[model samples]
Target: MRSKESDQTKEGSPSIVDSRFTQTLRNVQGLLKGRSFPGKVLITRLSGQLDESSIPPPAYLRSFSDSDVGPIELDNTFEDGFQSRSNSNASSSSSKMRTLSNTEAMSDQVQKSTMGARAIDSARLMKFTKELSTTTVILERLRELAWSGVPHQIRPKVWRLLLGYAPPNSDRRDGILRRKRQEYLDCAAQYYDISDMDRTDEEISMLHQIAVDCPRTVPDVAFFQQAEVQKSLERILYTWAIRHPASGYVQGINDLATPFLVVFLSEYLEGNVDGWSVADLPPSTISDVEADCYWCLSKLLDGMQDHYTFAQPGIQRLVFKLKELVRRIDERVSTHMEEQGLEFLQFAFRWFNCLLIREIPFHLVTRLWDTYIAEGDALPDFLVYISASFLLTWSDELLKLDFPEMVMFLQHLPTQSWSHIELEMVLSRAYMWHTMFNNSPSHLVN
Candidate 1:
């Protein structure tokens, strides 16, 4: 029973209950355009804006096909319109990213100038170096945005900016991500604004059915590389929740599918499902967005089905159980915080709501994601790790907190509180500490 966070802890026998549910994220991440997989909050933010800017299309755009956008006419009418967004908008992003990238590269070169040419050896090193520079610049931009608490609606544009992906309103020449969003918006606007005079109720019903079946007819994986993938994935999820009625699309499901669609839209779009709902789409060529949505939803709910138990399932039970686990794991920290008079629900809501997305920094979110994927069916491990990390790292600060201040800090806690180094230390040691204490002969609750 040594703590998973223990620095000196050793491995124990692995938990059973088939852990692949969480591992699929790795698979989806591999298929996406980005270098890493982000957890829920970040991914949801990215998914909405992965293609919002007007920068040039990524080099990989060709890998995804026009069909991936669902139902495109031969002319692809929306393409030209997306590319021509005003220069005022894109100039800011394009110039900003370039300045940051250049400055970062120069800094690295200056630092390594002492090392000589030997440092920039392989093509890979050059790439890594370049990306690192990009990373620093991007991180700064993200920090500024996060600090401002940008509205979720406008975040998609910021995401494309960070990825160096073109924005949604840019010319088609810029990049598929941008091109795709514009297209999605256009299609959305058009589909949502059908001409009642042109179509009867039967026709509308037929269109919906057609939309549901389009993915079946159009087997394209390239779409995952573009924004269409996200839209399609979302549609699939919504459709599934509606179709199932039993599992009406939950909040976290969107969070789950957003990044997956960001990476594997092509794979998802190619698949089909029963009870698809394409009744509202355009004629003959509409996308089966609904079928694929359900399929993707099913895929997501594949592993974590237990957590979604309805009626009188495990919801409250899990919460209380987690409280017990936290009590056992770190009563001193918990008691200290409670003594400060902070209600557990105030700041703790975000932890459970998004599964700790806001509790950890982006880097650690990725790291936690990596570990999460590596260890499926390890929900308790994740929850415990977050708890253990928060307590252990912030114990110093907590001991000094008077009540209101502690609640204030927790309620509006910044992502920076969960720094990568601290997170790594926690992940490596928390489990160790937990197991060690559990196995202790006569350990008393602090």
Candidate 2:
């Protein structure tokens, strides 16, 4: 793999040829933008994603008397890979924010035909489930349903249901405030075992205090930053636990809450008007939500199946499957790996299980959530497509390296965040590449 030497090569010379090639690539990419399904999918995905947040209620939004909806500022740190893509979708609601430049703002709207906001009925769910991971098809649907230039009246309700955030009520502030007030609790003790091993009465008692029982106080941990964010997550998990007691309080539940928290509460957190800190987040709800988020993460991990990924072989098998797919698809890349003498697991392990968790931006994480939600079940195809796209796009630089450099190359990607447009372009290129190579008997879908 080659390190980016164009910088070094252009140092002394005027390099008209290099300049021409760069312009040519850009023009080609521009042309491919609309026609390319993967590009369109990635573009919409980036545009639609959001980070977890705990936004405070606005002055106008507050109810006549009580309001637990504090002013929230967006947590930029957790806003990492999931929500940074800046497209038209980053606008405020049409009813609010006087900033409505046009009809198209938020892509998600209500579907009157569907009973709930999820817009997905059993029939639709069945259709979606069957179509799981055809990356091209998934990307196509993403682009088709994109909120690119939508009006609030036309946006679908299914999105809100999928993301797990209740949409703004007619009386937005009061509804949120009322929900917040009810969520706080104080008698709970910490339940460190989110992995949900069998515990004795003392432990169950502690979990009951915070998690299962009433009067819970969840801590203000780094991930579930806001009280409201934590509370909503708690509701999701407690409800889940009631539904599935055997799988209660698993470790990775927090990860599941992340997408919803960021989306629902992000607006409040981004504010600095009240100048209140989350450090002042109420003790009861904060700690409770964290426990719930952690436990929900456990539920998600339970969904993943196998022993927890703490020290075990669960993730390893997924990594191995990814490696298998990669090896089958591009033996040249595999050959490059062997020639460079890189241990495939060392750098790529994080890529598979975490699904680029620490790698992309917050907004992109939202976009990923959109696709992940839409995929319903076929995760591997989505995973392999993105992994392959990342590697292939970076191939020019990656091909110039040895094992150490390759490792360094993959690790350094998160440093330079990709915009929705760029990510879409990469996927488009990969889609085209796959179209060309797929007939040759090497593809993940096969």
Candidate 3:
């Protein structure tokens, strides 16, 4: 003879399962509310599930009220400070109960945060898709959207369009790409396919330098180290140098090609592009990728040819502008550097030459380029402000270090673990600084 409790337990099990199932449906419905056809299907399915009279209604779901959950907050406090305060209050059973309450609240916060992020990402992707779906893309609108950031899945197409390597008119896009790709092939055959005996002494020297630097480019990334990838780099660089005799080849120019290569190759591959094997692709496919990289790289360098030309006078001018801008924005940091006898060019030359590609991690390069390409012809002027913003980010640390230490620290900046959060902060600061200084002609004159 079992007790009444046993009967109750057996009877209540189905209700417990049904309640959980209903809660799951409610959550899914909340997620799908503003979505498309799938949302209608989910609503229909949920209505059928809710028809049972014995099943209770779901508990009223609380709204996710935190507005700051999705973005990277620039002014967040230290977690340790909050933890210390909480530790001080934990003294008795009641305090233990409060601790448990806090844990539940923290878990809820995390759930809401995750949901908020997903919603934001979904909305952004939809916006991009809508803009790109048109027969003729309005480039100004595309540039505005891309300036904020681009989604990874669609970044390749977006970069191509923004750089003018791909045509805006959908009707002309395919034909243009095919023509450009074939033109690149002809260029490769004429310039790169020739033997050393047929090449001039200067051409041979430049080819050797490019070959040497290709291996050294982004050495930390194994994707670049692949033999096929290196060969592609060599071909693109050499072909570009041969065509444009004015700038020819420069050491930092190899670093510039990397972002385009990674972006274009990502169109065909997925995952960490660094680990992808170019050899896995067909020869024709590799040639196409190389062609895209070459043209896009040329389009990019077209604006600031002096940056890689003899003596790189354009870079030197930008460096001077950065010094003046930094002086105006953060006088103390500038004074401290001057007191320590630190020159901006000693470190900022690399920043301007490579567009800070060497200064930041390889993965963040594409995200950074999205903004650079968006800047269009103004990139040279805007780059000075970006450099100043980047320098001022390390203002406090630079103030404490002497000249030698400053040189070492600036050269090997500790940015290996940096995520999009840090990079976005830098960009936001740069834009703010640009807005303040851009129209003021005298800001950089002194």
**Best candidate per lDDT, number?**
3
Residue runs of model 1 more than 4 Å from their true location after superposition? 1-230, 265-300, 310-315, 361-364, 380-382, 417-419, 437-446
Candidate ranking under TM-score, highest first, comes to 3, 2, 1
- Candidate 3's C-alpha lDDT? 0.77
Q: Give model 2's TM-score versus the native structure.
A: 0.47
Candidate 1: tens digits of C-alpha lDDT, residues 1-446: 44546512212224311123112222232333222111111111122223324122333111111111111122222233333333336557775565555555555654564344233223323332343334233444342222212222223233333333432233442456434445544554444444756655654554465344434321333333333444465445434544444545444444444332322222232233222233333532234323322333354355456545464233344445445555554455667866767656566544554556545543244334433332334444356445555545565577788888787776655556544434444443444344444344243233
| TM-score pick, better of 1 and 2 | 2
Question: Please, what are the lDDT tens digits per residue for candidate 2 over residues 243-348?
Answer: 3444454444434456544433333345422343445556554453443333324333444544233453655665665566555544557668878888767876
TM-scores of the candidates are 0.41, 0.47, 0.80
Better of 2 and 3 by TM-score: 3
The candidate that achieves the highest TM-score relative to the unseen native structure: 3
lDDT of 1 at 260: 29
Q: What tens-digit string does per-residue lDDT give for candidate 3 at 165-256?
A: 99989999999999999999999999999999999999999999999999999999999999989999999999999999998999999999
lDDT of 3 at 408: 99
